[model samples]
Target: MVHYLYLHGFASSPQSAKAQDLGDRFSRLNLSLNIPDLNQGDFSHLTLTRQIQQVSTLFPPGEAVRLIGSSFGGLTSAWLGEKYPQVERLVLLAPAFGFLEHWLPQIGEVQLRQWQQENYQAVYHYGEKRSLPLHYGFISDVRQYCELQLTRPVPTLILHGIEDRVIPIQASRDYQRDRPWVQLVELDSDHSLGNVLPEIGLAIQSFFSLK
Candidate 1:
């Protein structure tokens, strides 16, 4: 039995369009699809480590598992790939790496400090809530984890839009540089890839069919 774990992006939830689409596909195929809601409780104070741990506990062992993560969830999934050898394949869609190293400068210390203080949660149309306390330390931890802990190579599929403004397509290109097992696919769309879902779905189905 093939089990799938779907992780949503930052400030996103299991109710996103991609997650729902994948869930429908898995239902048709009679495979198990797990999309855990990661935004409950005091998420504002929760660290990335805690978040990943909570997500990890949802999986059942002794079955072939695959992970598909979007945006920040992609980073989480990559960390899981490094930690869990049993995961068969990892799919990252518009993943962000070195987020703090790059995006922090634009946020500025004053706004960041204010954001931390307020602990605000803003809801978006996609059913995700942007939580406060966006820790710079989380970025540092992710960078170190990706650099040192990610020594083992896992079969990975990376799907990104060529015109993604939020995460940029170059990050995916740069990620594929040293990772030979990674397969990169570029779509002619923006960050959402709204026009290319069918193609993305087909590619994922094809990839899973192969050895």
Candidate 2:
């Protein structure tokens, strides 16, 4: 059996609009789309490693998996595909590649150092609709998963927005550049990708059908 799973982005939940929308689409086709809560109700101690482990537990023995992820979750999906043979196909929406390099500058030098010293940073959790103190360990744990090590030939499809200021479209470009197993599709929307769900849904149907 092929398990279809959706992993929501950072500071988000299974109830995110995109996740729900995709879930509904899958339901209409008589398929189950399991959207796991990556935060595990503990936003303060979140890390990429934990997300990977959590999702890995869902993969049944001798079963294949098709992963669909957004942003941070997309990054996690990539790593999952790299580590697990069960993950045969991936659909990534605005994945955050070169994460720390992009985020540290946005957090700024002063705040970054302060977060390290303070051991926590007040990050707004979109899923919770409030701010939570995310541990600095999130950074250290992520550094362990280098993008260069993601050489797995898992069939992947990346849908990124040209106007995604949150995570530049160039990130996806850089990721798919040397990877022949990956396909990149550019959209006119932004990181939210709310307006292009139909297109994404259609692309997913076609991609999954071809192979």
Query: What is the lDDT of every predicted structure here?
Result: 0.74, 0.93
Off by over 4 Å in 2: none
> Under the 3 Å rule for N, CA and C atoms, how many clashes does model 1 have?
0
Per-residue lDDT of 80-109 in model 1, one digit per residue for the tens? 888777777988888776555556677778
Q: Per-residue alpha-carbon lDDT of model 2 for 81-135, expressed as tens digits?
A: 9999989999999998988887888889999899999999999989899999999
lDDT of 1: 0.74
Per TM-score, the best of the predicted structures is: 2
| TM-score, cand. 1 vs. native | 0.85
Q: What is the C-alpha RMSD of each candidate to the true structure, in Å?
A: 3.1, 1.3
- What's the TM-score of each model vs. the native? 0.85, 0.98
Error of 1 at 50 (Å): 1.9
